[model samples]
Target: MEYLKRFLKSIGWIARGVDLLVAPLTIISGLSFRAMKFIGVKKFPINNSLFHKIGFFPIVNHYYEPQFDFKGYSQKIRHFEGIDFNAEAQLTLLHSFEYKQELDALPNVKSDGGGYFFNNGSFESGDAECYFSLIRKFKPKKIIEVGSGYSTLMAVEAIKLNRMEGEENMCTITCIEPYEMQWLSDIEVELLTQKVEDADLGLFEKLEAGDILFIDSSHIIRPEGDVLFEIFEILPRLRSGVLIHFHDIFTPLNYPEKWLKEEFRMWNEQYLLEAFLSHNAKFEVVLALSYLTIYHKQEVCDTFPVYAKDAGKTLGSFWIRRL
Candidate 1:
């Protein structure tokens, strides 16, 4: 009987063209369970464990809309004891640096609904701003970013800010953009137009204690090449003091019922992190604020604040550093 109701409710959501078909099923199940109380059915007869494995539809329906929430933040993360990463402080680092002049110089698009958003390819304003914040805070001697886009510009601006402040380091930014987004080349960073795995990592020979490595490339190479190499192969080449950042560390809304799908294998950012954790190495999460995670060497993790703040935002990035 419960399955019949769930199936009918799922059809309703499916008929409505909603992305989360299971949402209606969960809602109907919850309501039916309550009504059963009057009829004296003390226990929920259906095996709902399977539905729970499908995705986060029930939580979204019962809680807030598909927006920022702690449920999203706490979903797939593995937290350790220490000072949580402070999202506000990290955001301040981005805000403190001057980017308005550069952002204003770029082209803008008037919104059909109301205000204007920039034409930069697929960059979320807050996300890009937070990336810039990391650059300002780390003040790394070298920044090697995979899958370059608007982040290249943020790195450039951060370096420019460092120079303006006379920080003495004079950071070098290198972008490995496989698609060769032409606009990114216009920036001041050293742009590599090849896939990340193919890029010459000879730059690592000169990598210093404060260098940073950012990974946001395709999870798996299309016809050939494995993206995991970016972590397994390239990471060993990097020295101990360097910081490693992984973007998109949470399951997407449309995640399939089975976790082992090829799409999940290729694009699910959490897979790579979990795989890395399985390896016998010391990697510490320094900052897990919003969707951005920054990690340093195990010894250095103790130095960072464990407190993370984003008010209420989640995009699922994680930080892991080799010890």
Candidate 2:
């Protein structure tokens, strides 16, 4: 019996020693996880030019601001330490990430109504600078945008400012919408070109590359969602130098309903991402205006369901050039 007691005591000591060793590692791992809660895991294959460079936290301004919920990957990244690898990750997590250059002024375009549409709000001076800068850099010959009315007006102003001329600086802008056309008296279009009924949109095949397309159709209807998906599928028709922009993402939330009465009138961002990604398009959220989303032909990912539970299919407002 005494020998058994000694054996038991030996086992207890060994167990205690093992716990002592394991505790610190376990605690360390737990702490690591907590740290990751704010940052997130470092991932490879950033997949998008906007997300590729690992520095300067893309869309970090309002992401971790604490006053509001960034939501999506940025929101998730703000909550974790490392694994939250989306654009929301701050410099603390990726101190080495590169901060890209931001454009400052419009090359040639000006807002017609005296205000630059930013974050769904009309912005002037510095606020509009970012929009102009985005226009200056993209230099799209073909422009496609989604949503309607106000956004279209703003885009018209941008196109006039950004369009460049070589032997012939030719550009075309297409806005896909189910609503009636509004007055574009603020901007000038040498030729209004042809009109495709909401049903005959299949004829967009002739747009070619270097043309821009915008999708601001309908944000509240399932058919509009389907239209967006169809447009994305036909992106191979775009010519080089194509530029596309998505409206409504200027609002923080991915859904159009989350927007205030004014914001509700615009398109949503979630659908834009889905259209781009599912069609293998590439794009970026211009820091000056996340609302001013950009796209080209590349391996983009689909993110349509990020906002609306009932979101139909992916639709986008970014530009694509046919290769």
Candidate 3:
């Protein structure tokens, strides 16, 4: 079955590549498809896969219309009349950077040792710095990290520092991840080798005020997916004052244009988060790395001059507090 699925996916990719090669012909084919539909044509001699391969069918073919007006939704969010949470979150992030020296003292943060390291692929662009600093600043008693990897390493280092400072309440760290990463076994965290959707919902309910729920989700919102479960099921069940971290979230702006057109990354987690926070008062933004990197460039540069020079001007970590 796996091989069959792979074969079908390969065929689909080939069709899309062929369509891109004959781009002008696909536009004409799209117009013809629309005209045929208007004349009460039920089916075409060619399969629907040919029409699906056309990139502009969602715009050109009336029958293959978009489900939502994404542009209008984005504009509405830009002009939202609610409290300026992004601005407030920027201040929170700036304050967290006061612990920069302490974060630097951690042995495993950027080390090339057997333990975890940060600022590598996927965790760079200032997100790793923000994560380590926030964990050090907040000193969350309990940290339940979903989809863990590099962030888990940061959390472990921060907790070690907290414990070293004689904070007796430095509590347990739990990581829920389906994929096998052997390094997790060496750490102090309780690793649950399963998907977040399959894990017990009670785990999230155990999180109290001042605890942390760090989520690095799949970014897709399909039915029964991890992103949907986190947004709908887990988020509502958490206690007030819980700090929630979402990685790879670029809010108050769309995902980068290059990421969309060139890389073909169709991530929609931030869009769902934007709609959820629209005039909703239960949750308040605590930190938005992308928002700060874009709008508050000077402050970020001053705070982490090395990161600014190395990673360029983009970060994807976002934080919020459950009110």
All candidates: TM-score: 0.54, 0.40, 0.75
Off by over 4 Å in 3: 1-77, 86-89, 105-112, 167-169
Error of 3 at 124 (Å): 2.0
Q: Name model 2 segments beyond 4 Å from true.
A: 1-131, 162-167, 175-181, 185-187, 190-203, 208-210, 221-233, 236-241, 250-272, 275-323
Which model, 2 or 3, shows the larger lDDT? 3
Best by TM-score: 3
Candidate 1: list runs displaced more than 4 Å: 1-121, 221-226, 251-266, 278-281, 290-313
Best by lDDT: 3
Candidate 1 has its poorest 10 consecutive residues by lDDT at: 299-308
Residue 19 of model 3, lDDT score: 67
Worst 10 residues of 2 by lDDT: 296-305
What are the RMSDs of all candidates, in order? Answer: 13.0, 22.8, 5.7
Q: Model 3: what TM-score?
A: 0.75
Tens digits of per-residue lDDT for model 3 on 236-269? 9999999999887777677765666557566888
Question: Whole-model lDDT for model 3 versus the true structure?
Answer: 0.74
